[model samples]
Target chain A: MKYIKVAGVVVFLLLWQLAGQINPGIYSSPTLVVTEIVRLFTEGGLLGLVFGTVATMLLGWAFAAVIGVFTGFLIGRYRLASLVLEPYLVALYSVPLIAVVPLLVIWFGIGQTFLLATIVVATGIMLVFPTAAGTRETVRVYDQVARAYCVSGRHFLFKVLLPGALPFIATGMRISVQRALMAVIVGQFLVGHPGLGTLLSDARVRLDADEVFAVALVALAVGAALTALVGWADRTLSAWRPEVTS
Target chain B: MTLAHGKTAAPTRLAALTGPGPVRDWTIRVAAFCALLLAWQLAAQNVSVAVLPTPRRVWEGMAGLLERGDLQLAWGQTAVQVAAGMLLSAVFGVVLGVLIGWFKPVDDAISPLLNAVFLMPRIALVPLIALWFGLQDTAKIALILSFSFFEIFFTVRNGVKTIENEFVEVAKAYCIPQWTVLRKVVLPAITPYVMTGLRLGLVYALVGVVLGGFFLESNGIGGLIYALGSDFRTAELIAALFTVMLVGLAVNLGLHRLENLLAPWKVTR
Candidate 1:
């Protein structure tokens, strides 16, 4: 199976290279993309652009995590609060967050401010649903346990509820990683900010297929790395989970 | 998912707060909404009216657009693209996912490619898509389709994987045909998972379609937002955004209702 997978990728790459060779103007080969990537790194400030995007993405994610987890916890704990806020929350959560980016761009003026706010709102709203649902489940499961033990509210919240919901929060965070990244990139793309998205868009304008592929490769690498990091966090955080017997 | 749960409970909560009567619940909910508007009005005072418009002004802007029929035109364009793209992906994604999962060789060949594509940020490809498709409805639909497809595909694949080997063996022992097993067992088993995927996909599709509108400079809610933003019409921008939110909430609620009707046993809180 592993060999088949490896061979499949190799065949795919070969076909792509062949297609590029046949239509060099429209398509770009792997070799050309590699050359462009190396050039971008050495001469084109690619690292800075990458870090700029990543930094903004991480910052937005941090804010989203804090706000989402806190609000979700509150909603889970106080059914009354959940009742009052649920409709608005659902409306906000369901809204195509990308649709709101222009408003942020208008409000924050097409720079890091717009980018960060867009990233935060997009990722934060996505994070809220899972975390809140997980928290609700935790509350349901642990209510009797906490009552039987006569645990204090704080104690029940921190020790029983939060821990029980950690796996769910982690899952939510993991899902949001991809979304936050996309939001930031699209935010930059729309606003013409100086990031990987800008680089990609610039290349598109110049009709530089190789340059586009180069920037995309970097994005792919970063995306894969972030996903791995989230997966690692999920595993470490969920060590107490029954599925982790190993 | 939980957001959808909140929508249904909202009416009941209002009743619970005001003692079991529809009128009382309606009054309480209206009061809460009024309080929110009042808070917004107060907050708007602190900022430039151009920066954060008062709720009243935003409502008026929405009302004006509605009266002029512009809001309907923009909303209809976006709605059509989102609905079409999501439906197409839902069908194609489930079929492809099932095919890949039901056959080991297919899975081995395709899983690696899917993983690679899935890990890559798709927003980076938007410009390329625009360049290729030229700022048209095709580009908008393509963007929505691309995002929705992978979401549904991955979820359905996982659903298929969850089917224990024993169940398949039992079916085979009872002389069940492959297609019949797939229809009776696999389809039913994956219904809930597919619905979950479809919900998430719907969200992504909406985002993609809206962004595509902004990118393509089309006559959609996103385009209206872009125009409002450029013109510094903050109130109108906010109004358009509110419209988008309403459309999203309505679609989400409708899907939730449909899911409940289709599989009553799978009703999730």
Candidate 2:
């Protein structure tokens, strides 16, 4: 299986290289992309671009995590709140929040504020459902015990509820990270912000396929690394929880 | 001693809170919606009309677009591209997913490539796609296909993997042909997943089409939105956004109903 996977990647790259050789204008091979990545890192300040994009994504995701978890707990703990809000939440989730980018650009303009706001709007609502579902499940399972022990208010919330819901919250966080990355890229791409997105768009305008592929590779690496980091944290933090397939 | 009675009391109280009461639910929903509208109206009054249009202004904007037939034309273009892209994705995704899931060699060979494509922010590919397909409906459809293909592929692949081995063995023991087994057993088992994939794919395709309009040749509702935003026509922009949201909600609800109808045994949320 491992050999097949390795062979598969090699074959794919070989085909790509062949295509690039045939049409050097449109297609970029792995080697060409790597050379371009090196040049961008050395001369183009690619690291700074990466830092800018990642910083925006993380800042927005942090805000989303705080807001979403709070709202999730509110609706999840109280049935009436859940009944009133769930329908709207579901509706919002179904619609691509990207549609609101124009409105945001109008309100915030084409800058850092616009980028951050776009990221938040795109990724925040996603966390709500998972967090709420987790909270509701925890309450369902532990409600009787907590009440019998006279556990209420902050104590019940912190000691009982938070730990129980951490796994689900972690899952939500992982998902949000992916979304936050995408949002940051799209935001930057659309507005030409100073990030990897800008790098991609700049390369495209110059018809530099190699540079575009290099920047895309960097973005892919960032996404994969963040997802892995979140997954690791989730596993470490929720080690006590029994494994249940979701 | 008291714990036993508390347990019995807890369930009833919980049920009272959580159980369905459609009348009460709808009333609260309506009330909440009205409160939201009132707040929006007040906020719009304070803000510049360029920043936030009042609800009535937005209504007028929608009416204006309708009268001019701009909304209809743009929406039709978007709908056609999305529909065409989704159809292509459904065919390719299901076929590839089934092949990858069913055969170990295919899984080992193709899964890595699929995962790489899936992980990359597909928006990053827009410029490249534009270069290849040019600024045409083809570019838009290609973008939509790229965006939506993964959801269907992954869902169907996972669904295929989860099919019980015993069912296949039983079919084999009963002397069922390979084609028959696949048709009767494999297809039915993955129906729910395909439905789920289609639902998710539709949402992503909507995003893709909008992006296509922004970057590629602007001809869809997304183009209208970009044009409105550029002109600082906040009311019409808001109206266009509302149209997108309404379309999303309607499609989602319609797919959900269809899913339930087709797969009555699976209660998907």
Candidate 3:
């Protein structure tokens, strides 16, 4: 299966190679893309820019995850609050994060303020759903168990609800992290002169197709890596979930 | 995802008063919304109107636009694009998803390829789409269709995949025709998944339409936002954003109800 997947990828890469040649003016060759990636890595000093962009993404996503989980857990445990907050969150989520970026820039300034807001908005929506749902799913059973032991609301919420909701939160986090990347990219495209997206926009101005593709690919790699690392952490900790408590 | 669920409830309020029973619920809910409005107005105080338009300004802007008649055309333009895109993607996504789930060969051939393409940030495809269709409504429609297709497709495939083999065996034992088996058994079985996907589709549908509309459509709220953002008209940006969220809130409610209505089997007694 791995070999087949590799073969499939190779075939896909080959198709791109052909497309590149068939229309070099519009689409550059894979070889050119590779060269551009190397140049950007070596001469362009793009790593710092990558870091600059990534830092906000990480920070913003972390902020979102923390708040989202807490709020979602709260909502799930408290149906009344959930009922109240649900309408607005859904409406907010339905609107594209891209659409919200301009608002962020206006509300928050163009630099870190805007970037963090963008990241928060991007990642924020996913957390609410999973945390809330997770709470509901396991809240009752776990509450029953806790109630038999005369557990407090805080104990029930922190210990019982949080545990059961972890898997769902983990899943939502995975999705949101990917979305955060997209959101960050879009936000940065508009506001970031120092981030990878800004680099992408710069390339667009120079009409540097290869560099544009390269910067985007690098960003994609980072995004994919972030998601994989999160998923890996989730899997590793999953077995040990029973051993840990809030 | 639970993300969709959060949209149903109202926002929070700062007021300390709490009554009992259903009255409390109603009061709290209304109070929450009012509090949000108050906070928004308060928050806008220090900021420039361009950066944060007051809630009243947005309302006035919306009302003024409505009075001017441009709002109707813009709304119609966006709605038509979304409707067209959703209708097309729904058919293709469900059919393709079903085919993949039902046939091993198709599943083997398609999933890997599609998944790979799915990873490619498709907003990048906007230029390619624009290049092909030019700066036209078709370009916008195409983008919408593309964004939504995979979402529905994956959901439907998951839906069909979840169908129990034991049920299939029962169908075979009863000598049910293939079409009837699919229509009666498989379709009903995946209704929830489809509904769930349909629910999610509302968000992405707007996304697809907005991206195209902003770039291509002459009259959408998206284009308006982009224009204001570029010109740095902060108040206008706020008003435009507020409108988008309001419209989305309404659309989501309608879709949620529709999903519940369509999935008659989701008996939540």
Tens digit per residue, CA lDDT, model 2, A105-189? 9999999899889888898887887788889899999999999999999999999999888888887887778788888888888
In model 2, what is the error at residue B176, expressed in angstroms? Answer: 4.3
How well does candidate 2 score on lDDT at residue A91?
89
Q: Estimate, for each residue in B79-145, the C-alpha lDDT of model 1 and write its tens digit.
A: 8888888888999999998888888788887788889778988776666676566677887888888
**Sorted by TM-score, highest first, which candidate order results?**
2, 1, 3
Model 2 CAPRI quality: medium
Full-model lDDT, candidate 1: 0.81
Model 3 stretches with alpha carbons more than 4 Å out: A1-7, A26-29, A77-80, A133-165, A203-216, A240-246, B1-19, B45-47, B127-135, B164-166, B170-192, B213-219, B266-269
**Could you give candidate 3's per-residue lDDT for residues A28-119 as a string of tens digits?**
76788899988987887788877876787889898899888887877887878876898777666666666766667767777777777888
- Which has the greatest lDDT? 2
Q: What TM-score, computed on C-alpha atoms, does each candidate reach?
A: 0.87, 0.93, 0.82
- Better-scoring candidate (lDDT), 1 or 2: 2
* C-alpha lDDT of residue A242 in model 1: 39
- DockQ (Cα-based) per candidate? 0.63, 0.64, 0.30
**Model 2 regions more than 4 Å off:** A243-246, B1-21, B164-166, B174-177, B267-269
Pitting candidate 1 against candidate 3, the one with the higher TM-score is: 1
Instruction: Give model 3's docking category.
Output: acceptable
**Prediction 3 TM-score vs. true:** 0.82
RMSD of each: 5.5, 4.3, 6.8
lDDT of 3 by residue, B32-65 (tens): 9999989999998878777677888878866776
